[model samples]
Target: MPFPLYLLAMAVFAMGTSEFMLAGLLPDIASGLDITVGTAGMLTPAFAIGMIVGAPLVAALARNWPSRSSLLGFILVFSAAHAVGAMTTSFPVLFATRVVAALANAGFLAVALTTAATLVSPDKKGRALAVLLSGTTVATIAGVPGGSVLGTLLGWRATFWAVAALCLPAALGILKGIPAGRVKEEATGGPALRTELAQLTRPRLLLVMLLGALVNAATFGSFTFLAPVVTDTAGLGELWISVALVLFGAGSFVGVTVAGRLSDQRPALVLAVGGPLLLIGWPALAILADKPVALLCLVFVQGALSFALGSTLITRVLYEAAEAPTMAGSYATAALNVGAAVGPLIAATTLSTTVGDLGPLWASGLLVAVALLIALPLRAVIAAGRSTEVLP
Candidate 1:
């Protein structure tokens, strides 16, 4: 692709790093701020809440702005929030900054999704989005771990500083790459803000977004408690936690890469094969939780299948919301964030029951089966779209 897409991915790497790296930095942050780790942990939900709200709210507010300006403004705000967060001694201040940074991240992602899809030809949208999302997968594999290691060696503030510094080049890229004066709405012939917002209520779009969210629910549910599943359920040591995470991330990268290439060409086939595998993979994972080798290996499979389904749903969201290009990205972003925020909360509830650590896996299975049931009536619709491509 385009050179600008790479820059967008770079910016997303910084955003994704800040989003996830907190998982590692929470203990250090709590210690430094003289707060409990539980207090520090609240930052994760704060960020998620911001993303859930900001993705739609900010995109709607800036719906009429030029793409380059909106994008640059978001990056600048994100960078500033990190810088302020790095210098603040107060936990509340840090918490506030995390929310601000997440808002900027959410806005940037919304605009960037449209920008990425707009930059390429119609058929290549999947590849473009794949390239953009790769940053997050790469962040999971490299940035999150590296941030943790960096914080351990230095301080939590250093990780914030590093993320701030990382955004400088991305800001520069935004300026250099996204051409000036391309009003986002005008480019796509997007309607008024009210009309754009109305797209969120469309039945087809709503169902697609719901399916995407459920897929992500399964993904985040499984991923959030992976450490417990590996260490407690599978009878592994702490060291195996990192190994399992890395394997999962590696599989996600492979999954997204493959889906990017194949989704538009054969979405029907992707849904046909990938969906059932995903549906069954969870129960198998839960059943084999006690078997170390089997459980660890299944983590990789789950990652691949889960992401492939999630990514396709995003592509479909854009298609279904074709009339509302500006908010289509918001719909997609908000859908995923909805899953991100709700999935873990739902999964956490299972821990209190007799199910214990195995609860998340079973919870994931129930969510996946429901998503596929929703998919059942929609298969004909999916197949009909690709006649010239796959359906024909």
Candidate 2:
């Protein structure tokens, strides 16, 4: 990969860390602000909601700005938000900081991926996207663990401070490493926006967005409550739960890498495989939760299969929506955040009155099965579209 790709990846790593670290730090943050852990948990959902709102808003506003400038500005905003969040004594203030930080994060990711795709040839788009997105997977493997450890030892605020420190170096790296002309310029003004919005109205693109949302809902619904389920139903110790999360992170690392490679070869097949795997894994996870050894294995498998869909789906959407790639990419990010927001809500509601923790898993499984059925007809639409040829 190019040096600019590495710089983009670094920014993504910090953003990923910032987004997920809240979960690990919730207890410390709650105690510090004299709020309930449930209230602290609201931070995660708040961030996702902000991302859903920010992706399109930022994309539309920054459409004419230089990509390099836009990226640097968003990083500055993100860094400042984290710094403020770390210093704040009030829960509400901290929550607002998180929301602002999430806005920056969502905009950065959408811009970064769109920028990455433009930097490479069409055939190599998947690889470029993979290189950029690997930072998020790496964050799962390294950033979350390190942040959690830091939070445990030095308090959650310290973790945010450390994360804030990273932003400066990441910004500097981007400034120095990425060339001015790295991002391709689109035709600007009213015509560009109109063209992009029209592409979004296409049935094929809309279906892909819906499929992306459904797939995410399926995976995240169960994943959002994984720790509690492990403790309550699996009868595992907290330490074991942490170990399982690490295992899941390991699987994500491998999965993202494999997905990157396979997407370049067969994007559609990757999606086809992912939907069924999600459907199977959820129910299987419910069954295996009682067996500690089996549960660990399932965690790895579930992580791998669940995340494997990402790169493939992204590349396919970009390909199919070539007329307005940036807008499509932004919409895709919005869809992802929408799923993130909805998934946990569904899981929490189902688990509220259930007999066991398995309720979430079963609910997630059924949701994925429905998504899979919906995707079948859409897959045919994509195939049929590809089969047609236009006359010169």
Candidate 3:
């Protein structure tokens, strides 16, 4: 609805591209850097670790800065870190660069969420947040595939270079579009932070965070090792694996778009429906892996249903902690990153010690079940919130 929101979306697109392109380019990066694929995979975790640590820390540090300036500075830092990553030949140096880049990227997202909330009226907050977050889905559909194709045609380093270049324009867009002032009129008094922290003490809000973590664990735990499972375990060709990824990305785009629209109407219903579908899709996917067509269909369904829950879940967190919207949003993002970091490591261990690729599916199913159980208790809370006179 706002021009500044569009600029923020572009920033999100660039960040998502940089973050997710690694999965497709992992092999290329490993070969280029004379490292194993296993080692290359660590970069994903590194980025998540950065996000987990950076979101709250940076949000706190930038609490007093003008939102526009903070966002622009973070983008510059993001661009610079990627530039350094593209140029580095040493493994340690590249790792450090990734950490810095991811930290900036996480900080950028936290600021962007806060900025988006400020850009819209209270009643339209859900839709506004959904529109801003939809950029991540768009990146999955367009940016990641485009960057992966470029990496295949050119080099992995070239992909990072492109991401770095995109960030420059994003930074400039934010500078020109967003007003240069503190986004929130409410002062970030010490008591405000304390109140925000206290919001987490509520069972409803805490349940939302735990559900967020479980949902992420269910999807990402299996997704992190998708390529290996497809190629090595399922006997699919490399090209097929790429096609599956693209299919998954397509599903993600559709899911998020639909979820965004539905969130404006009935967020709780979307989550109640979508969460179980995600759990169901995983086992179905594992069962159909040997059949190319079936597996592809399952991949699409899995991707769609898995990500479809995002907006609803995040909205749930915000609703539960309405008194501290920005801090709640930041913590929500932090919880997601923490899950992202933990999921893959747990999956990796399961795969190594277990009999089949089914390990991830089973584990994911269990995680999803736990998340669903958590959501059940919150039904009354959400229903009560909806019945209230609150507009947003």
The best candidate in terms of TM-score: 1
Put down candidate 3 lDDT per residue, 208-231, tens digits, no spaces.
677777777777887777777678
Ranking by lDDT: 1, 2, 3
The lDDT values for all models are 0.86, 0.77, 0.77
Q: Pick the candidate with the highest lDDT.
A: 1
Per-residue lDDT over 1-392 for candidate 1, one digit per residue giving the tens place of the 0 to 100 score: 99999999999999988988887788899999999999999999999999999999999888888899999999999999999999999999999998999899999999999888889887877788889988888888888778888998999999999999999999999899898976677635658777877877777778889998999988998788888888888889977877787788778888889988877777777788999999899999999989999987898898889888888888877777777878888888999999988888888899999989989988998899999998898786653342234321
Q: What's the lDDT for residue 231 in model 2?
A: 86
Clashing pairs in 3: none
**Distance from true location, Cα of 349 in model 1, Å:** 0.4
Worst 10 residues of 1 by lDDT: 383-392
What is the Cα-based TM-score of model 3? 0.92
* Residue 251 miss distance in model 1 (angstroms): 1.0
lDDT of 1 at 350: 94
Model 2: weakest 10-residue lDDT segment is 383-392
What tens-digit string does per-residue lDDT give for candidate 2 at 1-392? 67788899999899888877777888888899999998999999899999999987887777666789889999999999999989999988998998899889888877887788777766666677778877877887788888989999999989999889889999998888777665435554334777877887777777667766766776677776788777878888877766777777777767777877777556667767776787888899898788888888988887777677755666556666666756656777787777778877888788766545777788788877877788776665532222121011
Which of candidates 1 and 2 is the stronger one according to lDDT? 1
- Taking every candidate in turn, the Cα RMSD to the unseen true structure, in Å, is 2.2, 2.5, 2.6
- Predicted structure 3: lDDT: 0.77
